[model samples]
Target: MADEEVWKAIDDLHAWLDANKAVDGPEALLLRVLKLSEEVGEVAQAVIGATGQNPRKGTSHTWDDVRSELCDVVITALVALRTLTPDAREVFATHLAGVTERSLDGRTP
Candidate 1:
């Protein structure tokens, strides 16, 4: 999907979450930000499971599960950013551009 569509979906998800949330204001924003940590932990768990790192589990998850968990982390992060500001799309795009430039240093390889 396009960037615009992804942002629109994130906006909609944020609105839905806000409407259903029990808390509001700063508390809600804090919780939303904390949710990103939980998603990140899930990604770690998925990676471990996929690699059979936990002897007790023995490969309970596949690579696709890790991918899904990573996607969840991204979505949760974007939603948290949207909670912080309405210009999440622009903010993310600008930060991504700067990172890309710094990492590539004008090289195509």
Candidate 2:
């Protein structure tokens, strides 16, 4: 999603939580981050299984299956971060710009 959309969703969730009296500030944000991490791990597991690296006996999965779970990890991460920072846009803007610049500096061509 776009940065603005991410922030809007965060704002909406914050409002919902506040309306329900379930807001707990940083503690709640941390909990969501932990949950997001778990989802990311699942994505990694899916990747491993899809590539025959799981080694869990007969464990296996398809590329399509892994892609769906990988998307889950990304969505959970953006949502969780939105809960933490009100300026997720600035954060992504600055971070991604620097990363892209540095990455381009190392390109082979």
Candidate 3:
């Protein structure tokens, strides 16, 4: 049931992406990576801002501003791997299944 929902969510997101044309291949991957990196930077900025530490000139952000960037990184990684693997879904499934089994056995996969 847990795995069922996991794939279901991925499928749902894939469907949304299909409708939105947002998660293409390499080109999309490149863009997503860029977006993610930018977001990570923002998160860093937010940390700095929260600490009242001004990072050099024109470099500061907040928690919310950086979170989206981290999300972008995840999105881009999937897109990039998908671009290369063509069967990315299967790869992910197999890997997760292995990890899950390993976890159940209390061992590293």
Residue 62 miss distance in model 2 (angstroms): 1.4
lDDT of 3 by residue, 10-48 (tens): 566555655676656667656645655666666676667
Model number with the top lDDT: 1
RMSD of each: 1.1, 3.7, 5.6
Q: Over the stretch 1-109, how does candidate 2's per-residue lDDT look in tens digits?
A: 8856766776786567556645477777677778777997888888788788756644587889888998777667766666667776677678878888798995644
**Candidate 3 weakest ten by summed lDDT:** 75-84
| Sort by TM-score, top down from the best | 1, 2, 3
Q: Best-fitting candidate, measured by TM-score?
A: 1
Cα error, candidate 1, residue 7 (Å): 1.0
Q: Rank the candidates by lDDT, best first.
A: 1, 2, 3
* Candidate 1 per-residue C-alpha lDDT over 1-109 given as tens digits, one digit per residue, 9 for 90 to 100: 9978999999999999999999978898899999988999999999999999999989999999999999999999999999889999999999988888899997766
Off by over 4 Å in 3: 1-46, 49-51, 55-59, 100-109
lDDT, each prediction: 0.93, 0.73, 0.62
